[model samples]
Target: MMLSCKEATRLMSMQMDRELSMGERLQLALHLTACAGCRNFRKQIGFLRTVTRKFGDQIDDS
Candidate 1:
Protein backbone atom coordinates (compact mmCIF):
# COMPACT_ATOMS: atom_id res chain seq x y z
CA MET A 1 0.00 0.00 0.00
CA MET A 2 1.11 3.54 -0.81
CA LEU A 3 1.43 6.17 1.87
CA SER A 4 -0.17 9.57 1.72
CA CYS A 5 2.10 12.62 1.61
CA LYS A 6 1.14 13.48 5.19
CA GLU A 7 1.98 9.98 6.35
CA ALA A 8 5.22 9.97 4.39
CA THR A 9 6.21 13.32 5.91
CA ARG A 10 5.44 12.05 9.38
CA LEU A 11 7.52 8.96 8.78
CA MET A 12 10.37 11.07 7.49
CA SER A 13 10.30 13.24 10.62
CA MET A 14 10.06 10.16 12.82
CA GLN A 15 13.03 8.66 11.00
CA MET A 16 15.32 11.35 12.44
CA ASP A 17 14.40 10.25 15.95
CA ARG A 18 14.29 6.47 15.51
CA GLU A 19 14.65 3.54 13.16
CA LEU A 20 11.72 2.75 10.95
CA SER A 21 10.40 -0.76 10.49
CA MET A 22 10.87 -2.46 7.13
CA GLY A 23 7.25 -1.86 6.24
CA GLU A 24 7.41 1.85 7.08
CA ARG A 25 10.62 2.29 5.14
CA LEU A 26 9.19 0.53 2.12
CA GLN A 27 6.04 2.60 2.15
CA LEU A 28 7.90 5.90 2.56
CA ALA A 29 10.37 4.99 -0.16
CA LEU A 30 7.56 4.16 -2.52
CA HIS A 31 5.86 7.45 -1.79
CA LEU A 32 9.07 9.39 -2.26
CA THR A 33 9.74 7.74 -5.62
CA ALA A 34 6.60 9.26 -7.08
CA CYS A 35 6.23 12.44 -5.03
CA ALA A 36 8.69 15.20 -5.75
CA GLY A 37 7.38 17.38 -2.94
CA CYS A 38 7.92 14.73 -0.33
CA ARG A 39 11.35 13.99 -1.74
CA ASN A 40 12.28 17.64 -1.44
CA PHE A 41 10.88 17.75 2.04
CA ARG A 42 13.05 14.80 2.99
CA LYS A 43 16.12 16.45 1.55
CA GLN A 44 15.41 19.72 3.30
CA ILE A 45 14.91 17.98 6.61
CA GLY A 46 18.12 16.03 6.13
CA PHE A 47 20.00 19.25 5.41
CA LEU A 48 18.53 20.86 8.47
CA ARG A 49 19.55 17.89 10.60
CA THR A 50 23.11 18.05 9.34
CA VAL A 51 23.35 21.75 10.03
CA THR A 52 21.82 21.37 13.46
CA ARG A 53 24.25 18.61 14.42
CA LYS A 54 27.21 20.63 13.28
CA PHE A 55 26.00 23.64 15.20
CA GLY A 56 25.58 21.55 18.30
CA ASP A 57 29.08 20.15 17.87
CA GLN A 58 30.51 23.64 17.57
CA ILE A 59 28.73 24.69 20.72
CA ASP A 60 30.15 21.70 22.53
CA ASP A 61 33.63 22.65 21.39
CA SER A 62 33.25 26.20 22.62
Candidate 2:
Protein backbone atom coordinates (compact mmCIF):
# COMPACT_ATOMS: atom_id res chain seq x y z
CA MET A 1 0.00 0.00 0.00
CA MET A 2 1.21 3.46 -0.87
CA LEU A 3 1.75 5.55 2.20
CA SER A 4 0.90 9.23 2.53
CA CYS A 5 3.77 11.66 3.05
CA LYS A 6 2.94 12.09 6.69
CA GLU A 7 2.93 8.35 7.28
CA ALA A 8 6.22 7.99 5.49
CA THR A 9 7.76 10.81 7.49
CA ARG A 10 6.57 9.23 10.70
CA LEU A 11 8.19 5.98 9.65
CA MET A 12 11.44 7.88 9.16
CA SER A 13 12.29 7.67 12.84
CA MET A 14 11.49 3.97 13.11
CA GLN A 15 13.30 3.26 9.88
CA MET A 16 16.48 4.90 11.16
CA ASP A 17 16.63 2.61 14.15
CA ARG A 18 15.51 -0.43 12.09
CA GLU A 19 12.78 -0.85 14.66
CA LEU A 20 9.83 -1.37 12.38
CA SER A 21 8.45 -4.91 12.11
CA MET A 22 9.05 -6.84 8.88
CA GLY A 23 5.67 -5.92 7.47
CA GLU A 24 6.12 -2.28 8.37
CA ARG A 25 9.62 -2.38 6.94
CA LEU A 26 8.31 -3.81 3.71
CA GLN A 27 5.62 -1.19 3.50
CA LEU A 28 8.08 1.60 4.10
CA ALA A 29 10.55 0.11 1.66
CA LEU A 30 7.92 -0.05 -1.03
CA HIS A 31 6.82 3.48 -0.27
CA LEU A 32 10.37 4.75 -0.40
CA THR A 33 10.99 3.04 -3.73
CA ALA A 34 8.50 5.37 -5.38
CA CYS A 35 8.89 8.38 -3.12
CA ALA A 36 11.98 10.47 -3.72
CA GLY A 37 11.31 12.70 -0.75
CA CYS A 38 11.33 9.82 1.69
CA ARG A 39 14.25 8.25 -0.13
CA ASN A 40 16.23 11.44 0.30
CA PHE A 41 15.25 11.63 3.91
CA ARG A 42 16.48 8.08 4.40
CA LYS A 43 19.70 8.98 2.66
CA GLN A 44 20.14 12.01 4.88
CA ILE A 45 19.68 9.86 7.95
CA GLY A 46 22.17 7.35 6.60
CA PHE A 47 24.64 10.17 6.08
CA LEU A 48 24.08 11.32 9.62
CA ARG A 49 24.75 7.83 10.91
CA THR A 50 27.96 7.68 8.92
CA VAL A 51 29.09 11.05 10.22
CA THR A 52 28.37 9.98 13.78
CA ARG A 53 30.52 6.88 13.39
CA LYS A 54 33.33 8.92 11.90
CA PHE A 55 33.25 11.23 14.87
CA GLY A 56 33.26 8.27 17.23
CA ASP A 57 36.25 6.79 15.41
CA GLN A 58 38.12 10.08 15.63
CA ILE A 59 37.62 10.08 19.38
CA ASP A 60 38.78 6.47 19.57
CA ASP A 61 41.88 7.23 17.51
CA SER A 62 42.82 10.19 19.68
Candidate 3:
Protein backbone atom coordinates (compact mmCIF):
# COMPACT_ATOMS: atom_id res chain seq x y z
CA MET A 1 0.00 0.00 0.00
CA MET A 2 1.04 3.58 -0.74
CA LEU A 3 1.69 6.07 2.03
CA SER A 4 -0.01 9.42 2.39
CA CYS A 5 2.04 12.63 2.79
CA LYS A 6 1.31 12.70 6.52
CA GLU A 7 2.48 9.14 6.99
CA ALA A 8 5.54 9.69 4.81
CA THR A 9 6.54 12.79 6.77
CA ARG A 10 6.05 11.03 10.08
CA LEU A 11 8.14 8.12 8.91
CA MET A 12 10.86 10.50 7.78
CA SER A 13 11.02 12.07 11.25
CA MET A 14 10.90 8.73 12.98
CA GLN A 15 13.82 7.49 10.90
CA MET A 16 16.11 10.13 12.44
CA ASP A 17 15.34 8.73 15.87
CA ARG A 18 15.38 5.00 15.16
CA GLU A 19 15.87 2.36 12.52
CA LEU A 20 12.92 1.85 10.21
CA SER A 21 11.76 -1.59 9.22
CA MET A 22 12.59 -2.64 5.64
CA GLY A 23 8.92 -2.36 4.69
CA GLU A 24 8.69 1.16 6.10
CA ARG A 25 11.83 2.18 4.25
CA LEU A 26 10.45 0.81 0.98
CA GLN A 27 7.12 2.55 1.42
CA LEU A 28 8.72 5.87 2.30
CA ALA A 29 11.07 5.65 -0.66
CA LEU A 30 8.18 5.01 -3.01
CA HIS A 31 6.23 7.94 -1.64
CA LEU A 32 9.29 10.21 -1.87
CA THR A 33 9.76 9.33 -5.53
CA ALA A 34 6.34 10.83 -6.32
CA CYS A 35 5.96 13.59 -3.72
CA ALA A 36 8.09 16.70 -4.14
CA GLY A 37 6.78 18.34 -0.97
CA CYS A 38 7.69 15.38 1.16
CA ARG A 39 11.05 15.20 -0.53
CA ASN A 40 11.71 18.82 0.31
CA PHE A 41 10.60 18.27 3.85
CA ARG A 42 12.99 15.37 4.15
CA LYS A 43 15.87 17.45 2.85
CA GLN A 44 15.04 20.30 5.18
CA ILE A 45 14.93 18.04 8.19
CA GLY A 46 18.19 16.40 7.21
CA PHE A 47 19.84 19.78 6.87
CA LEU A 48 18.52 20.86 10.24
CA ARG A 49 19.80 17.69 11.85
CA THR A 50 23.24 18.13 10.39
CA VAL A 51 23.39 21.73 11.48
CA THR A 52 22.17 20.91 14.97
CA ARG A 53 24.73 18.17 15.39
CA LYS A 54 27.52 20.44 14.26
CA PHE A 55 26.41 23.15 16.62
CA GLY A 56 26.25 20.73 19.50
CA ASP A 57 29.69 19.44 18.70
CA GLN A 58 31.05 22.98 18.69
CA ILE A 59 29.50 23.60 22.08
CA ASP A 60 30.98 20.41 23.42
CA ASP A 61 34.43 21.45 22.21
CA SER A 62 34.18 24.83 23.89
Candidate 4:
Protein backbone atom coordinates (compact mmCIF):
# COMPACT_ATOMS: atom_id res chain seq x y z
CA MET A 1 0.00 0.00 0.00
CA MET A 2 1.16 3.45 -0.97
CA LEU A 3 1.65 5.84 1.90
CA SER A 4 -0.01 9.20 1.60
CA CYS A 5 2.01 12.39 2.10
CA LYS A 6 0.62 12.86 5.59
CA GLU A 7 1.52 9.32 6.67
CA ALA A 8 4.93 9.51 5.07
CA THR A 9 5.64 12.82 6.76
CA ARG A 10 4.55 11.44 10.09
CA LEU A 11 6.92 8.53 9.61
CA MET A 12 9.65 10.96 8.77
CA SER A 13 9.05 12.79 12.03
CA MET A 14 9.00 9.55 13.93
CA GLN A 15 12.29 8.55 12.39
CA MET A 16 13.97 11.43 14.21
CA ASP A 17 12.88 9.94 17.52
CA ARG A 18 13.61 6.27 17.01
CA GLU A 19 14.27 3.49 14.58
CA LEU A 20 11.56 2.57 12.11
CA SER A 21 10.87 -0.93 10.90
CA MET A 22 12.13 -1.87 7.46
CA GLY A 23 8.60 -1.62 6.07
CA GLU A 24 8.13 1.92 7.31
CA ARG A 25 11.46 3.03 5.90
CA LEU A 26 10.63 1.48 2.56
CA GLN A 27 7.28 3.23 2.41
CA LEU A 28 8.81 6.61 3.22
CA ALA A 29 11.48 6.13 0.57
CA LEU A 30 8.87 5.17 -1.99
CA HIS A 31 6.75 8.20 -1.14
CA LEU A 32 9.76 10.49 -1.31
CA THR A 33 10.70 9.13 -4.72
CA ALA A 34 7.35 10.14 -6.17
CA CYS A 35 6.47 13.25 -4.21
CA ALA A 36 8.67 16.27 -4.76
CA GLY A 37 6.96 18.29 -2.09
CA CYS A 38 7.51 15.60 0.46
CA ARG A 39 11.05 15.18 -0.71
CA ASN A 40 11.70 18.85 -0.10
CA PHE A 41 9.98 18.53 3.23
CA ARG A 42 12.22 15.60 4.04
CA LYS A 43 15.27 17.68 3.25
CA GLN A 44 14.05 20.61 5.26
CA ILE A 45 13.34 18.46 8.27
CA GLY A 46 16.69 16.76 7.94
CA PHE A 47 18.38 20.12 7.91
CA LEU A 48 16.40 21.23 10.90
CA ARG A 49 17.42 18.15 12.85
CA THR A 50 21.04 18.74 12.03
CA VAL A 51 20.85 22.37 13.05
CA THR A 52 19.09 21.60 16.29
CA ARG A 53 21.50 18.89 17.20
CA LYS A 54 24.39 21.29 16.74
CA PHE A 55 22.71 24.16 18.58
CA GLY A 56 19.94 22.83 20.76
CA ASP A 57 21.99 22.94 23.92
CA GLN A 58 23.18 26.42 23.22
CA ILE A 59 19.71 27.85 23.36
CA ASP A 60 18.30 28.73 26.77
CA ASP A 61 15.03 27.07 27.61
CA SER A 62 12.65 29.55 29.14
Best by lDDT: 3
TM-score of 1: 0.81
Q: How would you encode candidate 4's per-residue C-alpha lDDT over 1-62 as one tens digit per residue?
A: 99999998899899988999999999898888899999899899999988888896788977
Candidate 1, residue 16: the lDDT equals 92
Candidate 3, 3: how far from true, in Å? 0.5
Instruction: Give residue 53's error in model 2 in angstroms.
Output: 2.1
- Residue 43 miss distance in model 2 (angstroms): 0.8
Q: Which should have the higher TM-score, number 3 or number 4?
A: 3
What is candidate 1's lDDT per residue for 18-42, written digit by digit as tens?
9999999999988988999999999
Local accuracy by lDDT, each model? 0.92, 0.82, 0.95, 0.91
Report model 2's TM-score to 2 decimal places.
0.67
Cα shift from native, residue 29, model 4 (Å)? 1.2
- My TM-score estimates for the predictions, one after another, are 0.81, 0.67, 0.82, 0.78
Deviating ranges (above 4 Å) for candidate 4: 54-62
